[model samples]
Target: MFSTRPRDADAKQFIAEQKTLASIDQQVDAFHAAQPTAPDPVIIEHPIDPVLQTGDSQLLGGAMEIKSPWSEP
Candidate 1:
């Protein structure tokens, strides 16, 4: 009786939310479809030379100096 308008408004809001979700789903599907299908490389074939190899003069080897401007708690 008196609750008809509120019920209609709630239904309209629910439909609008569902439509927005559907649009987002469609956009996500389109983006996924546009991506390259080729399988990415998993392993590194060549060996890399280490920066802190053989002898380490300081603590954390070159990590602290490499990532300077850092704060310690």
Candidate 2:
């Protein structure tokens, strides 16, 4: 007769496999819901003017300047 609780290696392995199968099924369901239905394209405009560009070197260089310690107090 089988015990109320699992008592053998085969019973433990069966429980583990069942849990693994359940986890895999949950992941599959999530992935199916996350599937993309259509392709989306990104359109961007690149500026040609050197100084007028979004991240010009002059602007970023000045932004990195260390301020005076006296300004903190």
Q: Which ten residues in a row have the lowest lDDT in candidate 1?
A: 59-68
lDDT of 2 by residue, 1-73 (tens): 7667646877889999999999999999999999965434444434355555456554543222233333233
In candidate 1, which residue ranges exceed 4 Å CA deviation? 1-5, 39-73
Backbone clashes for every candidate come to 0, 0
Return the clash pairs for model 2, or none.
none
Model 2 stretches with alpha carbons more than 4 Å out:
1-7, 38-73
TM-score of every model versus the real structure:
0.46, 0.39
lDDT of each: 0.64, 0.64
RMSD of each candidate relative to the true structure? 11.4, 13.7
